[model samples]
Target: MSSQPPEPPPPNPTTAHGSDRKLRADARRNRERVLRTAQQLFATEGLGVSLDEIARRAGVGPGTVHRHFPAKEALYLAVATDQIRQLVAEAEALAASSDPAALFTLLSAMMASGAENVAVKSALVAAEFDLRTAAPDVAADLTRHVADLLDRAHAAGTVRSDLTVEEVMALVAGAFAAIRHIGAETSRDRSAHIAQLILDGLRPHPR
Candidate 1:
């Protein structure tokens, strides 16, 4: 009888694990792409843009968007959380720098990000989804970073002496409201002007 064919080599566990990791990474990248595309479409095109359209713009299958975010509100919350995480990353970078004015830099970034995500913020608020409660860890991380920067600003005499982190946070929130009140959420220059006016109050004034 003809010799039996050689047995196939055993499966390579290393290759299997590598493929698994790559698949996971690709899924994460697709999810992130979906969130960013949804955020842009929501800000510019409004919340009426469907999940399918977002997938099309993000260059992913509609199934990918739905797989990650099953509902509109879910997408809204994810987008909002992603925005704050970005601010937290910026705060981390600012913390690493020697700039005594880093606090102002971070605050400005926060305000600018808020202006860009105002629509998503409003949607979350309407749906009664507070990020502080929904994603407390990320919210706290940003606040903690802000507090650290505020302490630096105090040592360097960059900001008003008595300005607390709570107040700094409040001012950032107020800036968002002011931008919304004046319908400047869609206008970069207008929003930046409003942000400047709010941020000015944090600086030390003449005696």
Candidate 2:
């Protein structure tokens, strides 16, 4: 007698939400690992590194990596997004400071950090992949943070009032490009020096 399959166990309300939370947490951890591993490999190995290799280094299967990042470009963009987010946070903190020199110094450091991530530097050369266009929200947030910092510096009579926010951003981007020309290892020092030099040009001239 197929005893009515033992009455189905009562549904556990907490079980589903718990499982979902754990799954989301695990996914985030895996995604982070993938990004870190990819950044290292790409930096040392260039964009030629295989997805399988990234997955192996990340301790996840190739399918899992693909599930999170459907293509190589997507993964690269994710890395850039993460880097920009960190830079934006730093910019926000420095925006409140009265010291223009310190603010520019911090901005240079942030660009150096981005340069260190191989994928990010490489992506910089890819014209088809515009971080600002691809990740507008992140870019806008970052731009706003940077603008605020520039405005603060200008208000303090430290920075040039004639330069627009766009001009400052262009300088920052140009700094990164120049840093890339010198290579990532030297980019930090070179960028800081260049930033200071640019800052000199931006400073309010004494009448």
Q: Give Cα-based local distance difference scores for all models.
A: 0.94, 0.75
What is the C-alpha lDDT profile of model 2 across 14-114, one tens digit per residue? 99889999999999999999998987787678888888999999999999898988988888888888888878777766766657665566666665665
- The most accurate candidate by lDDT is 1
What is the alpha-carbon lDDT for the whole of candidate 1? 0.94
> Residue 117 deviation, candidate 1, in Å?
0.9
lDDT score at residue 7, model 2, on the 0-100 scale: 80
Global CA lDDT computed for model 2: 0.75
Q: What CA root-mean-square deviation does each model show from the true structure?
A: 2.3, 2.9
Report the alpha-carbon TM-score of model 2 versus the true structure.
0.82
* Winner by TM-score: 1
